[model samples]
Target: MKKNIPIFRTGDTIEVQVWVSEGSKRRIQLFEGIVISKRNRNFNFSFCVRKISNGDAIERVFHINSYNIGNVVIKKRGDVRKSKLYYLRNRIGKSAKIKELLTKK
Candidate 1:
């Protein structure tokens, strides 16, 4: 049986809550980053996230239908030119940044 998974697209800023196991205890960790790339349109889909951590750029890929994921929250929508923001990897400081979409009041 195929389970219905939540739909997520590229160029979206998402907050992923993942379950982490430490020793005999388990906890949920929150990771807030921008979606740089997405692959596989089916249940075996996965997406990559990029975030600057401690003066270093860190990128992580998460499965869309993984049980370890607690929740996926969209923070802000962005306007991007390409499907993959791989160019951002070569940039730093202000050059590697993405503009936020402002809504009209």
Candidate 2:
């Protein structure tokens, strides 16, 4: 993982800014979603984010040390017991939601 990236875990809602380049144009694209899983392997550390868009579920995997990742902002901390929230894939609406964890400070 990179030094600038903050500590995050599965079930957390996070917004990631990714740099997109199209020919001579370049822009930052935001992908906001819940982290379903994470893989830690030294330099190959990565996490998967899942979101619902246009009634379709979309999942994206991002490498922590990738240069294309501009930034990651944790929107909400989830109170989940499991490390991998793969069960959320089959859920919808309220069923797919995760409970928020209250933090002091």
Among these predictions, the greatest TM-score belongs to 2
User: In model 2, what lDDT does residue 102 have?
Assistant: 96
What are the candidates' C-alpha RMSDs?
A: 2.5, 1.2
Over 51-85, each residue of candidate 2 has an lDDT whose tens digit, in order, gives 99999999999998898999999999999999999
lDDT of each residue in 1-105, candidate 1, tens digit only: 225444556777889998999999999999998899999865577899998889888899988778788888888877777888888889989987778766687
Among these predictions, the greatest lDDT belongs to 2
Cα distance off (Å), candidate 1, residue 93? 1.4
* Clash pairs, model 1 backbone: none
Residue 21 of candidate 1: its Cα lDDT?
97
lDDT value, residue 47 of candidate 2:
99
